[model samples]
Target: MAQARCPLPSLLLVLVAVVLLVPRAAGYPWQVCGNTGSFTANSTYQANLALLAIALPKNISSSPDLFATTIVGAIPELVSALALCRGDANATTCSACLVTAFQDVQNVCSLDRSAAIYYDPCILYYSNDDSFLSSADNVASASTNRINLRNVTSDPARFNRLVGALVNATAEYAAYNSTRRYASGEADFDQEYPKVYSWAQCTPDLTPAQCRVCLAGIIAEMPRLFTDRVGGRVLGIRCSYRYEVFSFLNSPVMVQLAAESGNSGSPTPAMGPTSVTPSAAGGGEY
Candidate 1:
């Protein structure tokens, strides 16, 4: 008996499946505050913003802090701009991320006097007001993982506790231990399932205590903000935290650190097809 083959329809279906499976690059999310304030073309504020956009990336790349803040012109027309790259990012990555952010901000928030762009590798914020320089604004913008935590454990509550401990410890290490104010590591809950890899970072200008506070605030919000998610992040002007079941850091050092800490288990082999993409779910202005 010969089996009849439906090759054409089957091929089309396979192609459709492949397209759906591929992950698209979402880049980052940004906010432009037109009602809060705005600037017109050819205005002094606009000119200052243009200059700040060009200078911020360069300053960040050259500085040891991997953070840069500048005020162009006087207070009224002054444009207070800052660029903070993720602590683990290399200078090249920081520069490119800032460059993309600069262009993206202009496109997304064109003519707005106040705006901020949040990328996975960096953040760019500029405004007519300088208050953000010293203030810690936790609610400005944020996102979380698109996928939920695979229910690998019998006790989801216990999983949450272990994740919290790893994230909190990473925050402390970022705040007090690293010169770059960043830390990444992993923790093993079940030897057979994926180990949770996490990282936290703060802008170096913040005092250790301040950095801890910023990290803590976001960490506390995770359960409410992205419950049941295997990986997610909460970003703020002063600090941010991220964790995942995969190698989000994309660095071997994270694994080494976990091993040194005696949690040598690696992320569980992909049990199924899961997409670890970030989602721009909820974000609002300060």
Candidate 2:
């Protein structure tokens, strides 16, 4: 018989030391696996593993309320957590990004028990202990697209206009948005092509006001952290902000965030990135 295909984004194996994950045509975002480990055979360990795997994202579609249910049921635990980065990202891209992060947790954390994953547009968290629910207090994670800005200081006026709009619009969107939990926009500059392409988002679970607080914290750090030639950003479990001179998001987001929205307040003199404690975990490290 043809192999029974694994339909969802899952790794399944039974009665043996093995793993089988169906190839996802989609791509996942840039994620970090905070920590994770392999399981030895035993009733207790198996039960714990199952509990953490209680409800993956695909299952949520069938029972949307499952996310907030009790974390324990008999011996099985249900502490799964998943967040989409930006709706503009495609299913394939998101899938690929997630898989990359999953691999990290599996590889480095082969011995550790707790695990976390970070994707450019999403985050997946699971553990045998803490249920991260209602914990908007986790610290932030940061990274850059690795590309520099085209010409921020070199071409001051145009660069200022582009950055100003993105910083402002994204802050507003995160403060008040929908299931997408995202905001993105662009602005024109006098020197080069469309001056900027930008995007921002927070996990939907956060209240509108809470989202604002989280994103604002990140924005406050941009000036000094901001690289004049390349795109840079600070990513966190609750929120993320990013932009590039070139289009980097899905079509819808690309259209919206790359439209050259005009300038905002006078550009504050760029400052330095202050020291902020990095979250104990960004992506899991073995």
Top lDDT prediction, candidate number:
1
lDDT of 2 by residue, 137-221 (tens): 4443222223354555445544654574565565565455444556555555545554566776776677777776777776666
> Model 1 segments beyond 4 Å from truth?
1-35, 137-154, 252-286
Q: Which 10 successive residues of model 2 have the least lDDT summed?
A: 277-286
Clashing pairs in 1: 149-230, 194-268
Model 1 gets an lDDT of 0.67
lDDT of 1 by residue, 1-286 (tens): 9998879989899999999786332344644333357778899888888788788888888987778998899967898877788766888899889888878878867887877778778877777778888886543532223334455344455556556667776777677766777777676666544578887888787787888778877777766655545767766667888877776664433322231233323232212211221212311110
Q: Give the TM-score of candidate 1.
A: 0.73
Which regions in candidate 2 have their CA more than 4 angstroms from the true location?
1-47, 50-54, 60-80, 90-100, 128-131, 141-153, 157-161, 253-286
Tell me the lDDT of model 2 at 187.
52
Count of clashing residue pairs in every prediction: 2, 43
Estimated TM-score per prediction? 0.73, 0.62
CA lDDT of each prediction against the hidden true structure: 0.67, 0.50
**lDDT score of residue 183 within candidate 2:** 55
